[model samples]
Target: MTEYWRVKVDPRMCVRTGLCAASAPQEFQLDERTGQGRATAEVLSASEEVLEVAESCPIEAISITDAESGKAVFPPDD
Candidate 1:
């Protein structure tokens, strides 16, 4: 099975815009204290559409990671 990750926003890049959460409400949430976005999900479950949320990040702060491989699928440079 394709494992999912509890995505984390890069602090340096995150701007507290809350766009990721808006894009994928089920998978992500904003931390008002830190003004950062975090994954509210456990396993992405393939049917998940969080990738759209990650892409919506203006700074690309959101990352879609493959838990088993420990490799990132988005923010290609990372």
Candidate 2:
């Protein structure tokens, strides 16, 4: 089975701009209760949509990670 990537959300930083959802609707969702719809635990699908969303999150909560290696697709905030 293909491993899915991991995503970490800084809830404090998450303002719920919904850019990640708009960018990668298929890969991300916005939970009304949680108020943040980051990809919590998904195998690295590596679709253009998924990576684009991970890269485009305005609040920077959604991160696409390599399932096995746990490497983030995007670099840490520098």
Candidate 3:
């Protein structure tokens, strides 16, 4: 059985800092018209690069979560 994860960016919260795209070029990119960073696709595996992107989001717009559990991974549970 394979597990998956997904990346979410809140459009309302995003300020287009470009950190997400810069940090995870393989996973995120800027929208052509909006110039805001967005997930290129749903991530199927965990990667430290993705976590760094989420953490670097100045507005905390990026989030990564278990596809099934819907629990946050990066930024963790404090």
Candidate 4:
């Protein structure tokens, strides 16, 4: 079975960099009015591109977790 991931973008931490949308347009987008990075959906099929986008966030605003297990995937647990 394909794994799924929960994607989240912290509005407080997001700086409207647009990197996430630029890197993974299919999975992320920038709000036109708020200009904040947001996940296209709360959950999506796991992919390396999504993980990369989360890791590449300059402010670490994006986070990903295993949808089933709720385990941290990006900014991995210490």
Clash counts for all predictions: 0, 7, 0, 0
Candidate 3 lDDT at 20 equals 83
RMSD to truth, every model: 2.5, 3.2, 2.3, 1.4
Q: Rank the candidates by lDDT, best first.
A: 4, 3, 1, 2
Candidate 1 whole-model C-alpha lDDT, 0 to 1: 0.72
> What TM-score would you give candidate 4 relative to the actual structure?
0.95
For the record, the alpha-carbon RMSD of candidate 1 to the native fold, in angstroms, is: 2.5
Cα lDDT tens digits for candidate 1, 1-78: 355654667878888888877777787788878968777765564435777777778888877667677677776553
Q: Model 2 clash pairs?
A: 3-43, 4-42, 4-43, 4-44, 5-42, 5-43, 5-44
Runs off by more than 4 Å, candidate 1:
41-43
Error of 2 at 5 (Å): 2.1
Candidate 4: segments with Cα more than 4 A from true spot: none
Model 2, 1-78: lDDT tens digits are: 125656665677788887776666666667779767666345546666676676676756666666777666664435
What lDDT does the true structure give each of the candidates?
0.72, 0.64, 0.80, 0.92
Residue lDDT tens for model 4, 2-32: 3999999999999999999999999999999
TM-score of each: 0.75, 0.69, 0.83, 0.95
Clashing pairs in 1: none
Compared with the true structure, model 1 gives a TM-score of 0.75
Candidate achieving the largest TM-score: 4
Q: After superposition, how far is residue 19 of candidate 3 from its true place, in Å?
A: 1.1
